[model samples]
Target: MKKSIFLLALVIVFSSCNNTQKIAEITPNEIPSGNYEIKSIQGEPVYKLSFDVDTSENKISGKTNCNSYSGTFSLTNNKIEIGPLSATEMYCEENVMKVEHSLFEAFSNAKTFVYDNNMFVLSSETGIVLRAFRIVKK
Candidate 1:
């Protein structure tokens, strides 16, 4: 009886570990489709920038400040890639440019994203989170 109980406990522990690991993996469906807005930049508040994600075309197009930028993006289990972003060359004030640069860099380097309900959070490998809100269509 004691041996059987010990085996049961071991099985329970292994099963729990598997469940935890699975939770860490990001599923494809967790990524939302449609428009989004940047609610925060690098864990700080900033002017909202709208984003439109086309999962079918594997593209992410968005408006940052007064400039529009588009780029290719890919998302897999626990991984995200946004790169090769092309934007208008129009210049802006120093403060606005700083925010634009930070947003662009953060999005470009986002390695993972977590979405719950209509709220989306993008994070880098180092755990910096950029939160965004889903834009409801009229």
Candidate 2:
């Protein structure tokens, strides 16, 4: 009877450790803790696209192809909302303006986020709109 109890205790301890490991696996995929640069928009790479988020302050700022912008962001669980961004009025070529507009639309419509490895993807209900890669700041 004592041997059976010992075996049961060992099994319980191992199971607990296994559960903890599973939780740890998920922790890395959470909202990343540093700056990230916008790598793509709607599956197309855009020039000079950058993004930064401060999870601690629930704020986000970025530069599009033509202008710099800043805005507030909210995150609940995995859902994300960024909006009401105000940007500089400096004008640019028509193509650059178009890309900037697309970037703003993506951010305004963002509904959720996915983080894997060093990549962060922002998606709307329709589909992914932005993909960003983490930047390790020195």
Best-fitting candidate, scored by lDDT: 2
**Candidate 1 per-residue C-alpha lDDT over 52-118 given as tens digits, one digit per residue, 9 for 90 to 100:** 8887798888877768899998877757888889999889888888888988989887999887767
Instruction: List the candidates' TM-scores in order.
Output: 0.75, 0.74
Worst 10 residues of 1 by lDDT: 20-29
lDDT tens readout by residue for model 2, 1-138: 999999999999998887643323445326755678888888789655678878777778877667889888877778888878989988999989888888889999999988887789999999999998888655
Please report the TM-score between candidate 2 and the true structure: 0.74
Q: CA shift at 113, candidate 1, in angstroms?
A: 0.9
Q: Compute the lDDT of residue 100 as modeled in candidate 2.
A: 87
* Model 2 lDDT at residue 116: 84
